[model samples]
Target chain A: MRGVVMYTAGDVRVEERDDPKIVEPTDAIVKLTATCICGSDLWPYRGIEPADHQVMGHEYVGVVEEVGSEVKNVKVGDFVVGSFVISDNTCEICQAGFQSKCVHAEFVAQTIGTQAEKARIPHADGTLVATPGQPEPELIPSLLAASDVLGTGWYAAVAADAGPGKTVAVVGDGAVGLMAVLAAKQLGAERIIAMSRHPERQKLARYYGATDIVEERGEEGVAKIKELTGGLGAHSVVEAVGTQESFMQAVGATRGGGHLGYVGVNYDVKIPGIELFFAGIHTLGGPAPVRRFLPDLIQLIWDRKIDPGKVFDLTLPLEQAPEGYKAMDERRATKVILTF
Target chain B: MRGVVMYTAGDVRVEERDDPKIVEPTDAIVKLTATCICGSDLWPYRGIEPADHQVMGHEYVGVVEEVGSEVKNVKVGDFVVGSFVISDNTCEICQAGFQSKCVHAEFVAQTIGTQAEKARIPHADGTLVATPGQPEPELIPSLLAASDVLGTGWYAAVAADAGPGKTVAVVGDGAVGLMAVLAAKQLGAERIIAMSRHPERQKLARYYGATDIVEERGEEGVAKIKELTGGLGAHSVVEAVGTQESFMQAVGATRGGGHLGYVGVNYDVKIPGIELFFAGIHTLGGPAPVRRFLPDLIQLIWDRKIDPGKVFDLTLPLEQAPEGYKAMDERRATKVILTF
Candidate 1:
């Protein structure tokens, strides 16, 4: 089988690799139907993180080709979408809505990359949520979106406590951030602010129900948000960028007693304690427990309640995985979907 | 009127000052029955925080000698206890339960200097909670505790989400920390851990319902908490010390998806971003809006449901204010109460 591999930072290639097999009794072999490059993939691609002969990609919607005897929830020929992090959802932590930190969690595609033709999914019964039926080919991209970005964005909005009567601010214009706007809208936030400088991203943000857009960045961005919120800042803020500046902006953009839901994969950043304390913001975020929201997101997508697939501006064949990585890394595309 | 003033770091004096008078339509003049030195006062006394010719103390229980025409809720001759920060509890922020950040808030001791024979309280109707009736002289100390430390500790416990079936850990052993242990117990936390090295503080903590004591400091303290909680850390953590190390320890000792309520006045501390992001903790803390909880706390104190007055181990006449500050600064007393 052919798979995407990075021998070193900025050195990605599609190479022949061993076909993954059911290694654990709870594992399932997924025949890749669709997958995409996540914004987090840029971490290793930009030399910001360690990457040495590593498999790539963790977002996928696929058909189960084979399943171990212990896998009861899924079976061969079923279409399914699973979270980036595989979790045994029955654990105490998972039941408490922290599936990402489940004791038995394992990162899929770390070695047997999801970008490949086939991959082994551990804890299949708990990790994979099947589509109601065989989803239409047109719905594939949207279902794949629910596999990571949409689910992550929904989690961010929920964590930020965005709901009716809330004025929500989303920091970052990436796919996840834009999707968070959609999620906040779905959650009934009265006002939504999207902080973005990109005109294209801004348009999408508005379409996703952003009530306002702030073109400024950094302190100026926070100032604009405060100005729009009657000088109290937003009641809820979603941080979708992982850098120090964006994190601070998100923190600063929230009013006292507000909530900040952060989803950006933090890199090298130190949040000043005094500033955070003084801000008096309630915060909760991390690698989102996507598995917890997958079922609902899939239903919303299926009912056409949301169109998260619009984030995929470009698409390609599985063989062109490298180009997908390059396009997202260089900011030429919001996201890329690879169809097998 | 005589008030406690800090001429410089480590130098406190009781000196005659101009008597307070009604300065605003919402103001009231109170003859202090008692005022106490706080753990935060030691910050300036130890030179960790700068001190010039600043008036000292923020906690007080007193009799209302005069009320402005606009002060409707509180009347002259009413015995009351007021929060460290005076707030016009009618503001939107105050209505939302964040009275400390009310638009018309003034720090009591800092703005009006509560450690005086007579002090002016702004927004008297909203800032002060009157006791059931004029209290016996002996109840003054406990009522004074309700004004700040006790109410602040109760807020911390509530903010930390401590309750039945939860394990709570306290990361400071000052008067506020000991009081937090009591609050956590009153909130029905199943297991309460107090992290303290001082034997005296530990004894108070145990008496206040600390089920476990961790004498270790820093990383070891966190390790000890983990060891007691089956390696998952506490369900809730109350951080009453504002130092960077204590804040980090509180963060580290809380389980994933746990709550951390911090009440210590932060001075200078930088929190690493990745640690906070990955820890998956719900954090909420600051100068507690004691006004939000004063009515209930005063009721608890009045009913003999809790004895928070034990936190004050030293009492001195108003003329011995300097000695009261020194004793608390040197850790010779958990707290010092000065009588006029």
Candidate 2:
């Protein structure tokens, strides 16, 4: 199997690797149909997060090729979607809808990188959600989106409690932020604000049901959001960018008693307790329990209720994985999907 | 009028001061029946927080001596329980149950320092909750407790979602933390864990329905909580101390998907974004919206359903304000009630 690996910063290579087989009774081997490079992937690619010959890719949708004896929910020859972090849904945490922190959580990227021809999935019954039937080829991109970005955005919107009569502001124009706008819209938010300076992404955000767009960033951006929401800030704010600036912007753009949902993978962020205390808002975040939303997201995608796959602006063959990584790193593509 | 003022660290004195007069149409003059020294007061008293001859206290239960024309809910001669922070309660934030961040919020400590013979409570209709009737003398301390600590602890427990089938862990051993145990017990928590090293506070915690006590300070305390919760940590964590150590301990002691409610006046506390993000817990804190919970808390106290006044381990005349501060600072008292 050919898999993507980053040997160093700005170095992505697709190399032949040994095929994976089910080592555990609950495991299944999947033949990748679609996979993508994530915004988070750039952390390691740009050397912001350390990596040495690390396998790339966590988002994946595939066809189950085989399953070990104990695999129960998913079996051979089925189209399925799984989360970035594999989890045993039976754990106390998982049962509470936080599968990402499941007691037996296993990062698929660490053990079986999905940006490859074949990958092994552990705890298949708990991790993978199969479609009603083998999904049409056209549905691949959207299903793949549900594996991470869309699920993450959906969770962010949910955590922010974006619903009827609420004004939700998304503080990032990336795929996840754009998807959060769509999630908020789908969740019945009366108004959605997408804070973006990019015209192209702004257009997509509007298309995703954003009622307004604020090009300003930082304090100015927060001011614009507050102005838009009658000087009280938005009822719900979704933070998709993990930097300190983005975190503060999200906090600043939230109204008192509003919910601030941050799904960004934070780096070097230090939230001052005094400011947060006076902010008088509810904040909930972390690595999103993506698996918890997979079933609903998959159903929505299958029914064409949402087109989250629109986030993938660039698609490349597995052989062109390096370009896919480069295009996203340089901000030329919101997301890059690699076909196996 | 006489009021408590901190001239410098370790220097508290009851000094003659000008009488407070209604400045806002929403203000009311209240003759204090009881006032107390709070754990947070120690911040400035110990010189951890800056003070330049600042007036000392925010908690008080009093009789409404006079009311501005616009003060509707509270009338002259009414026995009233008011929040430390006066709010209009008509603002969007207040309407959303976050009166602490009300657009017209006025910190009583800064405006009409409660540790005095009388106070001018602004936004009286919103800030003051009238008792069913003038209470017996014995209820003064309990009503005073409701002005801050008890209400704050109740808000913390509510934020943590303490309820049936949940295990709640309180992180501080102060008045607020002990009250948090009571709140959790009242909220129907299946088990309550109180982290305390002092025998007196531990006994009070048990009296307030704490099912377990963990004397270990930091990491060890977290480990003990996890051990009690079958290795997953408590279902709800109340952080009544705002130090970095207490914040981290609260986060560490909560299970994934659990809630962490914090309400100590934060001083120089910084939450590491990375750890909080990966913790996968819900975090909600701030200066608690005590007014939002006042009516219910007052009713509970009036009916003798709960006795939060027991947290006041010392009573002193208003003239001995310095000794009250000293006793609390020396850890000789959990709380000090100063009778005017």
Candidate 3:
């Protein structure tokens, strides 16, 4: 089998690798149909996060090629979407809807490279959700997104409490941020503000339900959000960028007693306690429990209620995984889909 | 009139000062019935916070001495209990139950100290809640506790979502943390764990409703909490101390999908982003919006359903305020009350 791995920072390679087989009774062998490079993938590619022969993709939409005796939820020839974080989904944490932090949780990106012909999925019944049936050719991209990006963005909106009567502010214009705007609109936010400097991304943000756009960053951006919300910041804020400036801007943009949902945080960032204390808002974030929302999101995609696949601006074959990484690393593509 | 003032670190004095008079249409002059030294007061006295003849207290219960023309909610001779922070209550923030961050918010500790014969209170109608009538002499201390400590602890419990079937862990043993234990009990939490090393405080904690006591601090304390909760940590955690260790311990003691409500944050503590990001819990904290809880708290105190005044262990005449401060600073008293 062929798969992707990083020999070192900025060095992604697509090379022959031994094929994966069911290692446990709960495992299933997945023949990946589609996968993608993520904003988080850039962390290792840019050397901001260490990468030494590290396995790559965590998101995938695929067909079950083989299943162990105990794998009851998914079987051979079934189309499935799985969460980035593996979980049994029966633990107290997972049952509480925080599957990402399940007692048996493991990050797929750290253990399996899904940007390959095939991979082994553990806890198959709990982590993988089968679509109602085989998906249409056009729905593959959207189904792939349901594995991570779309579910994550939806979680961000839910955490931010973005709904009717809410004025939501999104800080970032990347794929996840744009997805968040889509989620906010779907969640019925009264007003949506996207902070982006790029005209192209800003246009897409508006297309996804952003009622206004601010081309500023940091303090100035917060001021603009306040100005738009009548001297009170937005009632809900989603932070999709990991930088210190972006985090603080998101914090400042949320009104007192509002909610702040953040994702994509960097290891180097440190939040001053005083600032958060004075801001006085409810905050909930971290690795999203994508599996919890996979069932609903897949249905939404299948019914054409949402088109999250539009976030994929570039596409390539699995053999060209290196180019996919490079494109995302250089910001040439908002997201890149890889076909096996 | 006489008031308590800190001349410098480790120096407190009771001296003659101008009697307060109504300054704004919404202002009211209150003759204090009782005032108490807070855990936060020790910060300035110990030189951790800057103090230069700073007027001293925030928590108080009193009789309304006078009111400006526009003051309607409270009037002269009415017994009242007021929040430490003044707010107009009509602002959006206040209406949303965050009166601490109201548009017209002002800290009484920063401006008019309440530890005096009489003090001027701004935003009288919004900041002060009148009791149904003059209270029995025995109720003065409990009513004073409602001004800050009791309200703050209640807010922490509410923010952490303490309720039936939840396991709550309190990270501080000060008056506020002890009050939090009481609050969690009243809020119907199934189990309450109080973390404290002091024998006396632990006894009081047990009396107030702590089902368990973990004398360990920092990481070990977190381990004890997890051990008690079947390795999942507590469902709700309250951080009543502001130090770095206490803050981190509070975070570590909360389960993945749990809630952490913090109060009394120091200015210098910086939370590492990676740690918080990985903790994956909901957080809501800051200076509590005491005014929002004033009415209910006053009612409870009036009905004698709770005895929050037991937190005050030392009582001294107004002229002996300096000694009261010394007792608290030297750890001889958990809390000190001052009287005219």
Candidate 4:
């Protein structure tokens, strides 16, 4: 099998790797039908995060090729979608809907790179959510997104308490941010504001349910949000970018007693205690517990209630994984889907 | 009128000052019945926070001496307890139960020091909660506690979602922390843990319903909390100290899906983004929106359901407010009350 790997910063390659196989009673071998590069993947590609032959992807929609004896819910020949974080969903944390921090959880990229032709999934029954049926080819990208970005955006919206009567502000123009706009809209936010400088992304954000687009960034962006909301700021804010500027903007754009849900993989960010304290808001952040939402999201996708796959602007063969990485690294694509 | 004033760092004096008079249509002048030195007051006295010729004190229970034309809920001769942050209570933020961040909010200490013969309270109808009747002198200290610490602790418990079946951990052993233990108990937390080093404070914490005590500080303290909660950490944590160590300990001692509520007046603290992001906890902080809880708190105090006044170990005449400040600054008193 050929999979994506990074030898060093900006040194991505598609090379031959050993095929995945079931190694534990709770494991399953998945033949990835689709996978994609993530915004966080750029962290290492830009030298901001260290990488030494690190396997590249975590999101995947696949068909189970083999299942171990203990994997009861999922079996071979099943079309499934799995979260980036594997969890034994029965654990206390997972049962409480924080599967991302599940007691027996592990990151898929750490054990089996999903960008490969085949990958081994641990805690198979709990981590993988089978679609009702084999999804249409065009729906593959959307299903892959449910593995991380879509579910993450959904969690962000839920954490921010986005619903009827809420004015939601999203900071960031990336895939996750756009998805968050969609989630907020789906969650019934009365108004959605997308902070974006790019006309293309701004258009997509509007298409996804953003009622307003603020082209400014940082303090100016926060001021614009306040101006739009009668000087009170938005009732909820989704921070999909993890920089200090983005975090502060999210916090600043939220009204007193509002919620700020941040999902970006934090880089070098520090929250000032005085400002955060005086801000008087609720904040919940971390890796999105995607597994918790997979069932409903998969149903939504299957029923055509949402088309989050539109986030994938570029598509390529798995062998062209390096080019897929390059497109996202250069900001030439919102997301790149790789089909095997 | 005589009021408490900080002439310099650690230098408190009771000096003659102009008597407060109603200045706003929503204002009322209150004759201080009881006032107390807060844990936060020690910040300036210890030189951690700057002090000049600043009027001191923000917590008080008093009798309404005069009312402006628009003061409706509270009137002359009414016994009332007011929050440290005076708010109009009708603003959207206040209506949403965040009076501390109310649009028309004002800090009592900045406008009219509470530790005085009489003080002017703005937004009288909103900031002051009148008792069912003139509270007995024996109830003065407890009513005074309602003005800040007790309300703050209640807010902390509420913010942390302390309720049946939850395990709550309190950081800091100050009056507020001890009060938080009491609040958690009243809020129905199944188990309450107080982290303290002082024997007296620990005893008070136990009396206030702390089911466990962890005397270790910093990482060791967090380790103990994890040990107590089956290595999963507490379900809810109250941070009553504003230092970085206390903040981090609160975050660290919370389970992945737990809640952290911090109400300490932050001095110099910065939350590292990466760790907090990965902590997977819901966090809410700020000055306590005490006004939101005053009605219920006052009712409880009036009904003799709680005795938060026990936290005030030292009582002095208003003329000896300086000594009260000294006692609190030197750690001789958990809280000091000054009576007229």
Q: Each candidate: what lDDT? A: 0.89, 0.91, 0.92, 0.91
Candidate 2 per-residue C-alpha lDDT over B241-314 given as tens digits, one digit per residue, 9 for 90 to 100:
88899999999999988999999646678889999998888988888899999999999999999999999989
Model 2, span A1-340: residue lDDT tens: 8999999889999998889988999999899999999898888888888889988889898999999899889989999999999999998899999999999898887767889988899999999999999888889999999999999999999999999999999999999999999999999999999999999999999999999989999999989998898889999999998888989999999998899999865668999888888887889998889989998999999899899989999999999999998998888899999996
Task: Point out where model 4 deviates above 4 Å.
Answer: none
Clashing residue pairs in candidate 2 are none
Q: Write the per-residue lDDT of candidate 3 for residues A1-340, one digit (tens) a residue.
A: 9899988888999988999988999999999999998888888888888899988899998999999999888889999999999999999999999999999999999998787888899999989999999999999999999888888888898889999999999999998999999999999999999999988899899999999999989999999999999998999999999888899999999998999998768887888898898899999988999989999899999999999999999999988989988888888999999996
Per-candidate TM vs. native? 0.98, 0.99, 0.99, 0.99
| The 10-residue segment with the lowest total lDDT in model 4 chain A | A263-272
TM-score of 2: 0.99
The alpha-carbon lDDT assigned to residue A134 of candidate 3 equals 98
**lDDT, candidate 3, B1-340, per-residue tens:** 9999999888989999999878899999999999989988888999998999999899988999899999999989999999999999999999999999898988999899987888999999999999999999899988999999999999999989899999999999999999999999999999999999999999999999999999999999999999999999999999999889999999999999899999878988888887888899999987899999989888888899988999999999988998999899889999999998
Q: Name model 2 segments beyond 4 Å from true.
A: none
How do the candidates rank by lDDT, highest first? 3, 2, 4, 1
Interface RMSD of 1: 1.7
Provide a comma-separated list of chain B TM-scores, one per candidate: 0.98, 0.98, 0.99, 0.98
